[model samples]
Target: MSIERDHRRAAIVALLLTALLSLPLSGSVLAAGQATPATTAPSPTPDPAAEALDRAIAYLIEQQADDGGFVGFEGVSDPGTTTDAILALKAAGIRGVATESLISSAIGYLEDAAGEYASSGPGQAAKVTLAAVAAGKDPTQFAGIDLIALATAPVATPAAGTPAALVGPGVYGDDLYDHALVLLALAAAGEPAPAEAIDALRATQAE
Candidate 1:
């Protein structure tokens, strides 16, 4: 029984790693040679990365509970996991009225739990912020110490003695991944991002 359990754990870990890795590859820009404009401005081809994200999102939708939230592998509709899935679809350019409605419902679920969420935890708030940003919605609905921190902070590279990330910054167990989400959200919103954030992202660009 223990061996079977161990194997199950390993498999779950593998799936998570694959999902996290696959998440970032879903927003590649078209190559210069392939950047021709549409004929009469016709609709563009479906991006391969977007197609991949659609499959992932389809799987997630299939697994959603009757309550309209996904049941995490661990249990419950964890805000963190849902946030990641939301951001992935958004990054893949899945922004439509239907998508927005679905995201709004999920936000309701997270809101119900926000009281217990750490007041000033950057990590937790980041997930919600990213999802809201992706949906092109204002984040005024979510206000807390963490949210305040974001509004007030210099948005600069962390000063000396500062950590690369704070505990609870959305993509748990992976500092770099969380940082990537923050950078992605800022870019999508046309927000003025810090040079260090840009530099850090450049460092992670895949060849």
Candidate 2:
């Protein structure tokens, strides 16, 4: 009798499970159950500034160096500059890449070169370190008082062809085109530009 009762109980449990599974459980029902309750509202039109910012970010991604680090001057190999370029992009809120492999390669270069140079000032290293940190890399590996000093200083404005000069005399200043790159980096980082800079950039756009 006990064995028969056990079998009956097992059958009842199986039937209940079958009934639950068979019930009409649509995706909408599941989604509603799992979602956090919230109020809905009408979507607003997109802002042109936001769109421009996104496009600028797209351009920066295009500007990424072949080795994963940013190149300030076309021919010069400066990791500090590269890190700054990356930081500026991050500050602008650009992320993800066309290819995962590309991002991975770029990060590897940043890791290897950060803290390896101090060309401009103690601040230059700091600026580059901030860029690395913003790019999701560990910033602790390359920490120094100089780094902090550089970041808080008034952000530098880049002029065309200035990058090479920053490298100093006899450092092959002609090819790096540092100024243009600095501007590009600042733009990429979305640093609130000087009034004139904003005007000039806006002037380039059309209705």
Best model number under TM-score: 1
lDDT of each: 0.56, 0.51
TM-scores vs. true structure, each candidate: 0.49, 0.39
Candidate 2 per-residue lDDT, tens place, 1-207, comes to: 999999999999999778768778865444423773565898999989778877876776676776777556665545766665555555564533233444455557766665455335434544554565566544434333233333323334443554433333222112233223334434434443345433443443457
Q: Which ten residues in a row have the lowest lDDT in candidate 2?
A: 169-178
Q: What lDDT would candidate 2 get against the real structure?
A: 0.51
Q: How high is the lDDT of residue 26 in model 1? A: 40
Question: What are the per-residue Cα lDDT tens digits for candidate 1 across 1-207?
Answer: 999999999999999778666654543534424654555767898788657766776776775555545577787776667776667656544443145555666666666655455233444555666766666655544633244245323333443443443322222223555466555545554565666555655655668
In model 2, where do residues sit more than 4 Å from their true spots? 1-46, 75-77, 94-105, 143-207
